[model samples]
Target: MYRHSATPRPYTTVVLAMSTDGKIADVARSPARFSSKSDRTHLETQIALADGVLFGASTLRAYGTTLGISNPQLLQLRQQGGVPPQPVQIVCSGSANLDPQMRFFRQQVPRWLLTTTAGATSWQKEQALGVGSFERILVADTSTGGIDWNNAFQQFFQLGVGRLAILGGGELVAALLAADLIDEFWLTVCPLILGGRTAPTPVEGEGFLSTLARSLELLSVQTIEQEVFLHYRLQRS
Candidate 1:
């Protein structure tokens, strides 16, 4: 088992999926699509549990995600229970893409854009954020040139985020894996064969905790129907 931090709060994660062949996308040819209702439900469940939800802006544009609970009654109950109406939806992009008209921006809950430069987004090029105080956080170091997970976490800590659920496109996931930042990996491998000559896997690069294979150890495995959900923990030597 990996030794837990005293606060037990490294970057928490929920890598929900309906991927077959252990790949996030069907092939490198196109965008990945979820094939199971159960998998989608699992993602929604995780979102409800988090204090904040984060991902890359490219994933945001690709997935067209609007972070909100679907069940109105449940959402109301959670709000009544002091759980907050919605988790802070966070995005990491070097160039800010402020699409104020997007449903996510329309929502009352604020969003955080962790950016490296003030270069405008395509959306922002057409129209700017006319309202709301959405955070535009500029990282101290541009040497990495992208969102630094450790630095981002320090920002999260300041925002009072205790737990986080992450939805990632491959690149961001790879970054988290390399940084050894992710707390848990929840993968729902679907029953489809996607043979792509060149495609991305669950994680990539020489980063994350990969050097120490023992850093992430399998904790549980289960197959509900045709889908497999693999859960792993960061193991310490």
Candidate 2:
């Protein structure tokens, strides 16, 4: 596993709502609306706690709008904590081939992008044309055309993001997991079965061998109605 220096990155937590069969989205990969309103509130609560929320391009494509804290109490709490009303919403993409007209760009929240040099160049051109919305574009790419997880997180820390929430579309979570950068998870298992080989899960990439699979220590579990809310901490060796 790749380890970072003594500089502390954000305390990263992944928040996801999956079906009973461990699928985050169906085979069609449309916006998953199977979770209940309670689950939405749970997600907003998690988002409210973070300094920034990170998600991938595919996720943004699936749901053109990012979740923001709308609960009045949650907004009040943020004010009391001396932070902005909404946390920064960061989109991570290698190619930065995002729609300029997505509803996400119009949302009243701080927006940022994490991408490669090539991606930044393209998006910067769009910015010059007055069609870009990202307040900051961070470029941290590896030689193999992949993101440098350690470098990205270090930049996140430098931006004063002490707490980060990962809202995933599987591949992003898998990359962070492989880097051993994720700290905890808030998983909500809804009462449904999205059983399809092509369906997306909370973690997706090349499957891990049993010997190399990461472990999680269950922190807590709660049954609300038919949904199961599970909290876990990644077990580091």
Candidate 3:
């Protein structure tokens, strides 16, 4: 298990589903059902376990996700954990070109916008007041074009989030991986193969060199029909 530092912060977990060839979406960047029903259920279970659920701009635009946990049993589990009935919904957009009218913002949950300096300006003008009832958090300046991952996590800690779930677009996951902030990874591998040269993978960015690559320790695995679910804990060392 990756241990937390002296200061309290959320356990960052990335939950994603891809095909056997490891593509989140098809070549056209269009959304499609690649994972099984079981995998979808598992995703809800993970969401129920989190204090906050995060998504990147591209994912949001592609799926128009509501970020809601639909199962009543899952809601009960959250209640038992002493977490809120609905986990906070968070969206990170470096460019802040999000549409306020998107279905995600219409959902009833504490929504938060984590954006960089450039994003703040775009958001203020494009998104009207009371449009989406989200808390705008501006991360301090950093080299990353997007909000600094380290600073965002610190802010999440200050907000009392103890477990955060990431359902991402590859670039966002890459940023977290580069910062070494993600603790656990849950990957659902569907049986199909999507062999598109332009298809997005689980991680995309200025990737680490072979010698600098991070490692993971397999935690558990579960199979349902043709789909396989994998759990791995990041080796913090």
Candidate 4:
């Protein structure tokens, strides 16, 4: 299935860390560590408030994530608050080459797999989403280019997906920002010195926002458990 997103207020978030030296991951290929319990708890708590969770396949592969937050108490709290028992987890695979056995697939949460033309594979999407009674939600595959972003956003809106929290290791955030689709950002800057050549910063867009020198205005800045949380908005200036 082809998909695209021409959303007006897609709440794409960029959540990650930066050390005193401005490093995000380890220097020698090690998993990034979270030092602040307060930051971790706060993030998961906010995640519980989101209608769904989105991330890229590269991020999943790097972290080996299931995409479902299964904390008993937290899930219970979310359920009591009338949120979905389990949030829908969406993965953007511009190449459509996601692993079938990744925890994201094994978990009981509903999964939406997005891909591009050069990346879209029929069998993989079907097997991954279990849309036999129907079909796996096929997002636009724009690998070779040509995506229907408007339709993608309409479908998500029809699905009652108004708010979205985009968790990242990178690429997805870059794309959303490039599209000028994100409305808000919840960024976390961690205080650690896990230097890495491969691990990247929060957003990789060139110039300012992404190659065009767009500016994001800071809305709120807070520190919890030694981590810095920065809330921002797209600058009209």
**Highest TM-score: which candidate?**
2
- What TM-scores do the predictions have? 0.80, 0.97, 0.92, 0.78
Which residue runs does candidate 4 get wrong by more than 4 Å?
1-9, 27-29, 70-77, 122-135, 146-151, 196-198, 205-211
Q: lDDT: which is higher, 1 or 2?
A: 2
Q: Taking the tens digit of each residue's C-alpha lDDT, what string does model 3 give over 50-70?
A: 888888888888987655887
- By summed lDDT, the worst window of 10 consecutive residues in model 1 runs over 1-10
Deviating ranges (above 4 Å) for candidate 1: 1-11, 28-31, 72-77, 97-103, 107-109, 119-140, 206-215
Model 2 C-alpha lDDT per residue in residues 1-237, reported as the tens digit of each score: 123447678999999999999999999998999999989999999999999999999999989989999999999999999999999999999899999889999999999999999999888888888875999999999999878988999999889898999999799999999887999999999999999999999999997999898999999999999999999998876
Alpha-carbon shift of residue 108 in model 4 (angstroms): 2.7
Estimate the overall C-alpha local distance difference test score of candidate 3: 0.83
Worst 10 residues of 3 by lDDT: 1-10
lDDT of 4 by residue, 69-114 (tens): 6668989987787878766677766666656655555567777765
Ranking of all predicted structures according to lDDT, beginning with the best and ending with the worst: 2, 3, 1, 4
**Tell me, what's the RMSD of every candidate?**
3.8, 2.0, 1.9, 4.7
Which candidate do you rate higher for TM-score, 3 or 4? 3
lDDT, each prediction: 0.67, 0.92, 0.83, 0.62
**TM match of model 4 to true structure:** 0.78
